[model samples]
Target: MSTVQRALAVGLGAALLQVLMVIAFAWPAADIAPRDLPLAVAGPQAGAVAGTLAAADPNAFEIITVTDAAAARTAITNREVYGAIVTGDGPPRMLVASGASPAVAQQLTRIGQQLSGVPVARAEDVVPADTDDPRGIAFGVMVLPLVMAGIAAGVLLTVVIPTVGGAVLGLVTFGVVGGLLSMTIVQGWLSVLPGPYPVLAAVAGLVSFAVAGSVAGLAAVFGRVGLGVAALTMLLIGNPLSAATSAPELLPQPWGAIGQLLPPGAAASLLRSVAFFDGAAAAAPLTVLAGWAVAALALFGIAALRGARTEVAAPAEDPLPVG
Candidate 1:
């Protein structure tokens, strides 16, 4: 192809990709809806309250009836439920764990107001976000940089050390350094991660490893095209679909469901569980991240072996005898 034609093609492709990203991300925010969101209802009238909520939105909530407000609070803190409605003789009370997701908390409070026969009063946040980050969105912000770092680490590693073993070493070092540094910034300085330091660091390391290893594997398999694909997948598709600023349930339809299974969403879920839920609901997300890491590593290994074999089969380059 001519240079001008090639440039035009590249430009058009980049423009199209950007447009797609915009649509993919904005579509969810345009029409937010709840889907199988966990919730607790307390008191003797809990069953009735749950029924009413069900009638309003049959598929919205997975309601669990608790004995009292205390139990409801416990459930929220443990991440067993996102929010709870505590019914009693006076006005109803709603308990929200803002640390998990401020957007979800706000939405649940609104739901409580609409559902309650009397006025609804919200209790103090069971697990509030960091004081500096009242909206709890800093967590989402932190994720972007870490992901970018992972991408950079993976790409640079391939450029600097093309061997699979070298790339693996680079990924390990990147994971450890990036994880600790990020944890120090978000947890130590910002007080965003209130969980145990060891747990937070461990999860961070896993997230880093998953992202880097996946990118490295893609590059190993498809060369430069693989790098572009990996970038698009992580930045355009994975991150936006993650719904890190809110609960996955608060996002639109299948996208929300799809996001939770990806690395970004899983990492966010795991972090929330660790920080606000005492690591109570972390197992599923942890498994998801582990799967990503293992799969990526396997792909990288296979590609490396194939590359080595190809090199062995190829004829050696002829050398000039004189200068």
Candidate 2:
């Protein structure tokens, strides 16, 4: 290719990358709305409440019927639903779990007002967020740093460490230390996460390992190209679609679901579960992180074995005859 052609190609590629980044980051925020967001209606008026919600926005919520307010609260605490409406002899009450997603809580609060046809309505926060970071801004912001740190760890391991075994060791060491440091800052200093320190540390470690290990393993096998691919996947695809800033149900359907399958999304979900929900509904995210971590380690081992076989197969040079 000519020099001018190459230059134009590079410029066009840069422009395309910028456009894709904008779409990845902004699209979800722009189109934020409930899509099959789980909501509960308790008491004898459950059907009526469901009908009202459906009439308002049929595709917004998936109404779950329960016996009473207590059941509704239980469901919210267990992370089964985002919020609930309870009706009895008196006026209806709105139950919200702001810790799950403050944005969703705000939406439900508006719905509550609409249902009552008043500026204010009877409402309760069954699972309120921490006072220190009520809006969940800090929680959302935490994931990006962790991801970047993981990427850096992977890059350093691949470049600085000469052997696969050393890289694996470095990855593990980074995970443990990184987890401890992260938990200390976010939990101890920031007080954004209220979970038990040990568990939170462990979760943080797993997240680091999952991300770093994936990057390192890929790079070990495929070199610099693999490094770029892994980093971009975690940053562009994983970070934005993670829904850490909002609930997964709030984002576009399949993308939100796909995000949870990636490291960033799984980490956010797992952290939230341990931090506020007492580890409720944690099985899926935990599995996702574990799977990534295990697979990454396996890749590293494969690379090491390949290196060993190549070394053994290589023929040695012949000794020079004495002069």
Candidate 3:
């Protein structure tokens, strides 16, 4: 291609990349709404509340009926649902877990007001967020740094280390140290995350390892091209689809579910679970992170074997002539 054409092509590519990044980050926020969002209706009026919610927005919530308000609280604590409505002899009460998802809680609070025909309805936050970061802003802000750390670790290891084993060791060490450092800042200093220090640190470390390992493994197998691919995927797709700023159910359908499968999304969910819900509903995210880490290790193994074979097949050079 001519010089001018190449320049134009590069400019166009950059523009396209910017456009895609915008869409990935903004689309979910623009399209935020409940789709099959889990909710509970407890007490004798459970059926009536469910019917009313169905009439309002048939697809808004996946209703789970329970015997009483206590059961509803249990469900919320267990991360089975975002919120609940309880009805008895008196006025209805709304139960929310703002720590689990402040966005969901706000929406449910609105719904509760509408249901009671009052400007402010009776609402209780079963699992309130920490006082230091009531809006969950700190938690949301944590995702990007973790991702960047992973990308940096991966890129540096691939460029600096000559062997895959060395890269793996370095990545592991980074994960552990990074986790401790991150927890110290976010939990100890800022007091954002309220989970047990040990567990939170462990989850953070695993998240770091998952991202860094994947990137390094990809680079090991496919060289620089693989590094680019991993970085872009984690930054553009994984970060946005992570729904760290909001609940997954609040985002567009399927994409929200799809996000949970990626490292960023899984890490966000896992962190939230451990921090607020006492590790409730943490199995899926844990599994996803583990799967990525395992797959990355497998990739590293494959690259090592390939490198070994290449070395074995290489022809030996002739000995230098003696004087």
Model 3 residue 66 lDDT score: 90
Q: What is the alpha-carbon lDDT for the whole of candidate 2? A: 0.92
For each candidate in the order shown, give its overall lDDT on alpha carbons. 0.84, 0.92, 0.92
Q: Model 1, 18-74: lDDT tens per residue? A: 899888778877877778899999987788888988999899999998999889888
Q: Score residue 268 of candidate 3 by CA lDDT.
A: 93
lDDT (tens digit, per residue) of candidate 2 on 9-68: 999999999998999999999999999999999988889989988998999999999999
Which tens-of-lDDT digit does each residue in 1-323 have in candidate 3? 99999999999999999999999999998999999999999988889999999999999999999999889999999999999999997767899999988888899999998887887675899999888988888889899999989999999999999898999899889989999999999999999889899899999999999999999999999999999999999999899999888899999989999999999999999998999999999999999999999998999999999999999999999999999
What does candidate 3 score on TM?
Answer: 0.97
Q: Lowest summed-lDDT stretch of 10 residues in model 2?
A: 114-123
The per-prediction tally of clashing pairs is: 0, 0, 0
Stretches of model 1 off by over 4 angstroms after superposition = 116-120, 311-323
RMSD of 3: 1.5
Candidate 1 residue 42 Cα shift, in angstroms, is 2.1
